[model samples]
Target: MKAPRAVIFVSLFLLTFQSKAQTKFDHSIWDQILLLNVTKDGKVNYGGFMKDSSQLYEYFTLLSQNPPTEQWSKEEKLAYWINAYNAYTIKLVIDSYPISSIKDIKDPWNKKFFKINGEWYSLNDLEHKILRKMNDPRIHFAINCASFSCPVVWNRAYTGANVESALENQTKKFINDPLRNTITEDVVSVSKIFSWYKKDFKIDGKNVVDFINKYATTKIINQSKKGYKTYDWSLNE
Candidate 1:
């Protein structure tokens, strides 16, 4: 015996409503937090954060308690995890305030400080298990590791609505920023991000140089030299 027509309609309405609610993850909180603590050049004011750590904790708590549901779009999920990863990295730095580098904490990436969806996650787990698995090589430029060599943290948050443009802009910025990547006419010196995650950049058979050239204003030629810059592990402050 099938359910009544009214019962079926009510069930459908409830399901749609639940899906909409679950997908409505607000990232404005993160935007406000970033605007307050981050500078125009992406430098984080940990000293200011030390005074008001409650907002950071609140953001983390929000992420922990409300993991994105399957109803969320791919862009939404990607933006959420990228923000989470960067936010947690900031938390780690703040927790160990006055440290010279993120490396100052033993196995910083492996520490299980992030609780999400009833499971604990470390920075490494989130980056490798989730973000990387998303198959978007551009993520390497979006998730900052709180190091000088890491991609510059955008002054604003990554919202699903703007994530695509944000990622594109950041990739271009990182490639063009002389401090992070130097693209000369004959030589392309780049951050270790490309060397470390070479395979990720090789999606669709594109090599590291091909990937870099996509955003490099100088446009590396076929025979141009490639060199990896020494990674600076010092705090990005």
Candidate 2:
């Protein structure tokens, strides 16, 4: 009798704990990245680019600690890491305050700017190790590098449930802006993101032209003669 009762108690405890965890956050945790906008004339002001790396880190750590016992058809871990990488990238820039560009950070050829669960890694590691491992291409839209060339920073937190839609919206918004995308009568120019993640697009049944045409404001779908514009790696500050 005692043994049976003890087993039931443990099961109930586990259920309660799982219930609490599930209720924690329907959405991904987010910290605002404070954007200090500086004008060419030397005027500077906070432009609402707040991002919370701590919240992102803590969430991913939880996912890392316990591989979800529940059946998860959606990508929680991969999406979380993507958000973490982007958030941390911003934090890295803010840590150095007044950086001219993300590349300004001196990452040794051997050591890039990425780390997993506390280990040092390069930006390559985050995309290749975590994101690519998940086999998802939408991630290209979610991870901003704090550069003029990178995707615009989203205002909302990306939760497991909404990450898919969030990324779709992000993709559409990013590729249509003339500042981000340039098209002329003869040639079409796109952001460097398409170049960096060219494989991600091609692997997912898309080419440079195929990818941009989905979001290009113009009805033209010119696959040939497509060119990548020179990127402004300068910081968005």
Candidate 3:
């Protein structure tokens, strides 16, 4: 009897743990994001984006409608908040209709732009505190700030499965483009991103050039050019 009872207890514990693990995330909407329009200029045209503001209002409703006492895994939390930030930022831009920059949609001092996970939050807080703090640097390029200086929006949506690879490609492509980097045998100059986020690229005793070199085109690596150009941030309109 004791042996049979022990087996039952073990079985029950394993089932409970599996349920907890699988329940950490709800990924049903991942496909919807991937389906949204992403353009080569890295613009999220979000055709009818203004009309889509209603969608965001509904999504935010889901997050705040429930208060979860159940602890979510870090990956689950990061993915949810990042998506929320991007969605809300885009909504903010479209809501104003003729906005020139994302800055135009936000408060100067950085206050609540929307409610998320039951808390009022700002784009600045979400990017700096949640994403960067989580060590996911690729997000810098993936989230569009409605500026031409920002990374080109890719053609696909960000899904949980491809999130890491998508971010890597964005960083590499943005850093290596001639518009973003200047390469020479003796010296190299690149976007302020190279300087500002050096830690992200310094994975193995490498600086920005070393990082860009991995994806730099032949012309870029030869350093046969005079100089690199700055990206015009005048809204991608």
* Best prediction by lDDT: 1
Rank candidates, TM-score, best first.
1, 2, 3
Using all chains and alpha carbons, the TM-scores for the candidates as numbered come to 0.93, 0.73, 0.71
lDDT tens digits, residue span 85-132, model 2:
665665567666666776887762234554444566666666677677
136 in model 2: Cα distance from truth in Å? 2.3
Query: Candidate 1: which stretches are off by over 4 Å?
Result: 1-11, 222-224
Tens digits of per-residue lDDT for model 3 on 95-134?
6767566567547227676775567877778777767777
lDDT by residue (1-237, candidate 1, tens digit) is 999999999999999998788885777778887888889888988887766678778887889888878888999999999999998998889888899999999899999986897798999998999999999999999998999899889979898899999999999998999998887876667888887898999878778888888888888784447788999999988
Give the C-alpha miss distance for residue 5 in model 1, angstroms: 6.8
lDDT of 3: 0.61
lDDT of 2: 0.62
lDDT of 3 at 139: 69
lDDT (Cα atoms) of all candidates against the true structure = 0.88, 0.62, 0.61
RMSD values for the candidates in order, in angstroms, are 2.0, 5.2, 4.7
* Candidates by lDDT, descending order: 1, 2, 3
Q: Please give the distance, in angstroms, between residue 56's alpha carbon in candidate 1 and its true position after superposition.
A: 1.6
Worst 10 residues of 2 by lDDT: 41-50
User: Of models 1 and 3, which has the larger lDDT?
Assistant: 1
Q: Which stretches of candidate 3 lie over 4 Å from their true place?
A: 1-36, 63-78, 106-109, 182-189, 218-231
